[model samples]
Target: MAKHYIDTQSLGRGPQRLAGQARVADLSRLVSDLPAQGDLVVDWSVAGRADSAGRNFVLVQAQGSVVLQCQRCMKPFEWPLDISNEVEVVATEAELELDDDDVEGPDRIFCEGRLDALGLVEDELILSVPYVPRHEVCPGNQPDAAPEDEPPAKRESPFAVLGSLKKP
Candidate 1:
């Protein structure tokens, strides 16, 4: 369905890997988090493999940075992106439903023929975004001035002691 779609069955039979880098703007949902395009770039990959138990899984990974306005200070800050997820692939909806209750197990998805490669990557990226965008510490934390009632803390110059010693 997508340009990057791949068949899960093929992936399970033989290990296959796909990777690429794309501008943040290319991700429809995640791009909305950016204040500006800036240098935001996403590197992503999808790989398929089978465990010793013969269970088929798709591994997805993506990393990037997004520029966002701080909910606290209203200043733009960079949010680092790191996403890594693995999901089991099932051929039928019944299998997906049966696997759904196993919360501890890897997520499961159904595949008729192929999986949407780009769509999967985009979903993972979107989940990485914070519900409320904010910086750990706002970059614009510097206050403009001292409060009206308080005087600025006076600083004693390091040379003051030397100057006193030099007094004749």
Candidate 2:
């Protein structure tokens, strides 16, 4: 079982509360290939909870600061991430129905084996990131005209965004 696994025994005893700190550089999957891992850190908490209907669930909350390359400026900018989600627990993977056209219920996760904590938080962090990260306004981009002495900087093609997807 994973070291951070949340087993049924813990849930049976009562609600389980967990919290920790993880450096952004340590979570390879969370910030893959982003420059300047630096001292960025994420504070995360996971709690076993039950809804009003008594259905078992896990409430995952995470707060972190990340650096993302601006799609417009191609420069790095800080983005704050505060994610909280309640995922319903199911007995088996078969209960997860993605094709249901009816009113969708809360997110569902299987309760078999081990429910990895760090992995779950990382997943939520990834989803919290903007599809296309950009700064409100690029640095030095003002209403005033550019100085003539400084040569025009080369601009990256729009496809530059796809560079992150290429195999290293």
Candidate 3:
């Protein structure tokens, strides 16, 4: 069985915290089965809040880092993540819409009044990746450009000059 990421749903009503480690890969999968390599130590703390509908929610502050491929270079790199996010998991869409007291953004999603913090952790980590991947220093230097206006000139080979010399 794969190791389950520590869940922190119980903390919505009060200060809650969870700490665990998972692999850097398997990030795309909803339930990541992290490899035995480096594990990302995730630490999350939530101070509960109430939405517009008076439904209780949690304000999550997560800090962690994962190894991800650079969008530009396809090379493996470490991406650090420290986010102050507020996710209001309400009972229904109407409740979320009617609630006007808190700031609503696309990050908000309606669930069955249950917060799956592990899922949220996976998503936020993925969102942190840059669209373009690039290496710090790409291999191979740029080719030297010849002067465009210069006419073609015949160049003598060093071997040809050596061949013309007669040995005594």
Candidate 4:
């Protein structure tokens, strides 16, 4: 499918809304971080409006699910994605910098007329992913756990071996 691009300037002139679905496979950057197997679904929407202060802002909402490797079990698990963000559109870098100190304000983005909607969705989705993903309770036995029947192998300490080799 052909990609869509938005004119930030036009969005600023009036309120606008957009919604779409993007296959996880199509988002290369986001897909790279996910596991090879399983299907991923991404649904997203955006609403643009001019605030009372005359600042242009876009409200982004996205939901999806992808198979991610569990850090604890070293197995694949389905991870759900849900994200919502309000981004202020700024005309220049200076404007973005000025808003940096406003800790409570919405996030800012610089636009040069056009913006890629798919890229925005992908970025937000990536940010929503957890730093370390794992199931609440592992699905099966822990990988490092020793089997119930056999005793763990015993090995002498390297230091003890070295001491024995040294002259008395």
By lDDT, who's the top model here?
4
- Rank by lDDT, highest first: 4, 1, 2, 3
lDDT at position 3, candidate 4: 71
* lDDT (tens digit, per residue) of candidate 3 on 1-168: 133332234344445444454444445462243223265565655445554545455566667765656555555665566867666565567766664755545345666634555566667665654555555664443456679998777898869978768697
lDDT of 2: 0.79
lDDT of 1 by residue, 1-168 (tens): 226866777765788777888788767677764677676788889988877777778899998887778889888777888999998888888888884567799988788777887788888888888889887766657558878999889999988898778857
At residue 41, give the lDDT of candidate 1: 85
- Put down candidate 2 lDDT per residue, 57-145, tens digits, no spaces: 88889998998898897999889989999887776677777545645567887776457788888888988889899888789775677
Segments in model 1 whose C-alpha atoms lie over 4 Å from true places: 52-54, 142-168
Task: Return the TM-score for candidate 2, rounded to 2 decimals.
Answer: 0.75
Better of 1 and 4 by lDDT: 4
Instruction: Work out the TM-score per prediction.
Output: 0.75, 0.75, 0.54, 0.79
Clashing pairs in 4: none
Each model's lDDT comes to 0.80, 0.79, 0.55, 0.81
Report clashes for each candidate as comma-separated counts: 0, 0, 9, 0
lDDT of 1: 0.80
Candidate 1 vs candidate 3: the lDDT winner is 1
Runs in model 4 lying further than 4 Å from the true structure = 141-168
